[model samples]
Target: MKVEIWSDVMCPFCYIGKNNFEKALEDLPFKDEIEVEWKSFQLDPTLDPDQTKTTFEYFREKKGFPEAQAKQMIGQVSQMGIKSGIKFNFDKALITNTFSAHKLLHLAKKYKKANEMEEALFIAHFIEGKNVGHIDTLVAIAGSLGINTDEARQVLTSEEFNDEVKNDFSEAGSHGISGVPFFILNGKYSVSGAQPVEFFANALQQTYEETVIPLKNISGGDNSCDADGCSI
Candidate 1:
């Protein structure tokens, strides 16, 4: 079964959800048969790539959130991150456009390293407080993932994988997904938000059972048909 996940690097819940989903997969007996693909989604596409602001400030200024409310809301999310084993430093997080980052992810996808790229980006933005919108930052991240630095730079410097990122956005819209951390199992079942581990496990188990059929050995003992002849 294939699991497609739509998420943004800047979204805290997305990272938490990823951790939970992976944990769920770990407990499954057929985990090796599962394939996971990470899709791109921008929570705020209109954000300026050069913009430099803390997440707290961004929420306070752009979202019309009061200072106290912003801190409180961010604090709540931080607590949630703790439970999911993620340490979100909203205070140090930089607010910038994720377009280039999404493009980088597309580049990584070609190497089957999209999941690693996604995890790196989440850590960069939410933990290390790095500027994901910057090409140099992206290049360094790509290097760390064992992707060719020059090729990654070339891709980021140009419009490579732009359509792939846009297609992910378009597909998400078509699916009526307006949020990050949305999961689609086998293109049939959908699980939205940072749901609990059990939610993902159940979805995975159900989807696996429905999609993967086991072959039954119907041959009776000493009465099975062979390539030469049937033993009746």
Candidate 2:
């Protein structure tokens, strides 16, 4: 079975949903047969990469949320992360465009290191507060996952994987996906937001039931063969 997830690294719920979905897989009977493909979704594609504002500032200005509300909102998300065993340092996060970062993800997908790339990017942005839009930082992250740094730099320096990122965005639009961390299982079941682990597990179960062929008698047999003789 295949699971395609549309998410943005800058989206806090995406990371949380990822962990929750993973936790659900742990208890799933057919977990070994599952394939997860991460898709690109940018929350703000128009953002400037050279911006020096922090996550707090971005939420306050662009989102039109008051400073107190922003802190309270992130505070709630931070508690959720802690419960999921993830540490989020939202205050230190940098506000920058993830177009180039999404491009690297496409490159990573080519080398079968997409998951590693996604994890590293999320950690860098939410925990380590690294500027994911920068080429050097992306190269280092890609290098840590055994990706060729020079190749990564070359890709970043040019318009490589740009179309792939845009295509993902277009696909998301087709699916009516307006938010991040949206999961499509087997292209049949859709689960939105960071739901509980049980919800994902139930979806997996439902998919299995719907897809697995059941054993049934198609015909009646009138004759049988025994060990010593054949009955007619």
Candidate 3:
């Protein structure tokens, strides 16, 4: 079974969703056959990455939320992260556009390190307060993953993988997905938001079983006599 996740690195719930789904996969009976593909979704694509505004400031100015309310929201999300074994430090988080980060993610997917890239990017922005939108920071992150630093930088410096990122966005739009942490299982079953671990486990189990077991064939089989001789 294939699971496709559409999320943004800057979304607090997206990281939490990642943890929850991963926990479910750990216990999945057919985990070895499951393929996970992380796609990109920008919550605010028009935001300027080079702006001096902080995440809290963006919330206050752009979203029109008061400082107290923003802090409360972050606190609540942080509590959710704690349950998922994730440490979120929103106080130090940066506010920047994630388009470049998404492009880099596409590159990581090519090398089969997209999951690692996503996790590292999340930690960098939320916990370490690193500038994930910066090219240098992304190149360093890729290097840590054993990806060729020069090659990664070359991709970042150029317009590489931009179409791939855009394609993911287009696909998300077509799926009517307007939020982060949206998960699609086998392109059939979809679970939105950071649901509990049990929800993910059940979805995984159901998809696997339905795919492996064929539905009853109610159509006619080989011709046979039924109360009379069958005619060709």
Candidate 4:
């Protein structure tokens, strides 16, 4: 089974969703047969990559939330992150464009390390508060994933994988996905938002059963043998 996740690194719920989805995958009998692909989606594509606005400031200024309300909302999200085994430091988070980070993810896809790259990007943004949009940070992340730093730098410095990232954006639009952490199981079932582990597990199980074709008993019981007796 293949699972495609449309996520944004800067989105707090995306990281939480990732953890929940992985936890669900852990107990699956067909976990080894599952393939996961990370697709990019930008919540603020117009944000300047060079800007150094904190997430709190973005919420207050851009989202029109009051200071206290913004802090309270962020606190709530932080609690959610904690529940998902993540430490989300919104105070340290910078609101920079994730387009470059998405491009780097496409580069990682070439090495079959996109999922690892996504996790690293999420940590950099939500936990470590690193500038994921910066080329230096992305190259460092790529190197950590066993991807060649030079190649990673070349991709970041140039327009490499730009189309892949844009295509992911287009695909997300086509799927009418306006939020992060959207999951498509086997290209059939869609699960939106950072749902609980049980929700993901149920979706995975259901999708697996629906996608996998059952063997047809052409002979029926005419020539079948039972545990108690054989049909002769």
Query: Compared with the true structure, what per-residue lDDT tens digits does model 3 show for residues 117-198?
Result: 9999999998999988898999999999999999989998898998999999999888877776778888667777777788
Q: Give the clash count for each candidate.
A: 0, 0, 0, 0
Predicted candidate 4 versus true structure: per-residue lDDT over 62-173, tens digit per residue: 7777889777867777787798899888878887888989999998899898889989998888888899988899999999999999999998888888889999989988
The number of residue pairs in model 2 that clash at the backbone is: 0
Please say which candidate is ahead in lDDT: 1 or 4.
1
TM-scores, each model vs. reference: 0.90, 0.89, 0.89, 0.89
lDDT of each: 0.82, 0.80, 0.80, 0.80
Give lDDT tens digits, candidate 2, residues 1-232. 9889888888777888788889989988799999999999887877898665796787777777788987886787788789877999987899799899999999999999898898999999999999999999999999999999999999999999999999999998888777767778787767777766777788777776786443221112212111121122
Off by over 4 Å in 2: 212-232
Which residue pairs does candidate 2 place in steric collision? none
- Candidate 4: clashing pairs of residues: none
- Scored by lDDT, model 1 comes in at 0.82
Candidate 1, which segments miss by more than 4 Å at Cα?
211-232
RMSD to the true structure for each prediction, in A, is: 14.2, 15.3, 13.8, 13.1
Model 3: lowest-lDDT 10 consecutive positions: 223-232
- Candidate 2 lDDT trough over 10 residues, lowest sum: 221-230
